[model samples]
Target: MTKDPTIAIRDCLAEIAVLHGIAAQKTLHEFRNDAVARRAAAYAIQTISEAVRRIPEDWLADFPTEPWGQIKGIGNRLRHEYFRVDDGILWEIMTTDMHALKTVREAMLARHAGAS
Candidate 1:
């Protein structure tokens, strides 16, 4: 039902990565005591999860290196088990993993420049 869904997904992933990075910064601690950090982290995780979920399951077979299913699973867990969210685990994903995922998403966008 959506045109260029892949492009849309790539864009969302990039956005999530950027937002996650911003939230990950120590300066953001000023907001951490409030809802800012949690909100940003929640949005980032939701966006990533949505994008991953929209991908056809078989599409992941085309990119064996991508953690396509894992992304979807994480998103589900975060959304369904909000009470169980582990801040430390979220920090790891935001700081260590999102950067690499963002890079891959950027490459996807670049490869489909005309789509945008």
Candidate 2:
């Protein structure tokens, strides 16, 4: 059976949140120095971006507060240009952008849950 897109999005968001939380405790220097941590964070980000790309455009359109295009672009960049990924950009994205995305994701999940 096909999974509901809404549920898939929620799951992805939850995963992103967990990954962010795991990385949150470590300093930027730690993240930069630890290849394992960096890879884990990168994978989580790529996963979230991939899921965001799969979400229906109409549903995404409803969330004007989120940066949908940029999210998708990040996924594309990560997928296509893995070798060129910059640690500083990843740090900025994880620290700032992910929080905004998580807030939007939570709101969307809540709204969907209410509708159901």
Candidate 3:
């Protein structure tokens, strides 16, 4: 059975929230120095990337500019090249990209709330 796209959206959104909680306040240097925060954020990012892959492109039509493909790559890097994952890049994504992704996700939820 196919997983529902909206559920995927929510799952990713939930993980993004987890990421923010893990590193939203810390500066880049602070975030990079903490091993636990890095791992937690990486895990959350992996989860979000998995969920992002599940969501259909048609459902995301409203947000044409979003880098859906690159977003999916995050999980691949985390899963396959685990040792090479960069903390600074992850911090940038979590701090800057996540809010935009979160906004898109919230908009997605609002856009599809009636259907579910």
Candidate 4:
């Protein structure tokens, strides 16, 4: 059976929170210099991407602001264009976009929790 869509949203929120924690540990300069942090972030982004993709289309329609297409594209780029990945861009995107994603996801979870 297909996994529940809400579970994917929860996973996305969890990964975003984890990525924020990683970002907290370092400045952009420090993040670029730290291989472990960078790798962890990449994995988190990949997970977030996958989780976003897993969200059902109907449920995703409820959050129209999210750029699900581009989010999935980022994961593809990370996987297939690994060598060309820019640390600065990754750091910037994570720090900038994550807040919006997290907020909506938290609301999504809350909305679902109330439904259940």
**Candidate 2 segments exceeding 4 Å error:** 114-116
Candidate-wise lDDT, in order: 0.68, 0.77, 0.86, 0.86
TM-score of every model versus the real structure? 0.74, 0.86, 0.90, 0.92
Q: What is the lDDT of residue 88 in candidate 1?
A: 65
In model 2, the Cα lDDT at residue 68 comes to 81
Can you write out model 1's per-residue Cα lDDT over 40-96, one digit (the tens) per residue?
A: 777688778787665555544546787877777887888889778776666677777
Give the candidate number with the greatest lDDT. Answer: 3
Q: Once superposed on the true structure, which residue ranges of model 1 sit more than 4 Å away at CA?
A: 27-32, 56-59
For each predicted model, how many residue pairs clash, with residues at least 3 apart or on different chains? 0, 0, 0, 0
RMSD of 2: 1.9
lDDT of 3: 0.86
RMSD per model, one decimal: 3.1, 1.9, 1.5, 1.5
Give the lowest summed-lDDT range of ten residues in model 4. Answer: 107-116
Stretches of candidate 3 exceeding 4 Å from the true structure: none
> Best TM-score goes to which candidate?
4
Candidate 1 has its poorest 10 consecutive residues by lDDT at 26-35
Residues 1-116 of candidate 2 have per-residue lDDT tens digits of 55566775786787677667756778888888988877777788888888887676777887977778887788778888978999878888878877778887877777676443
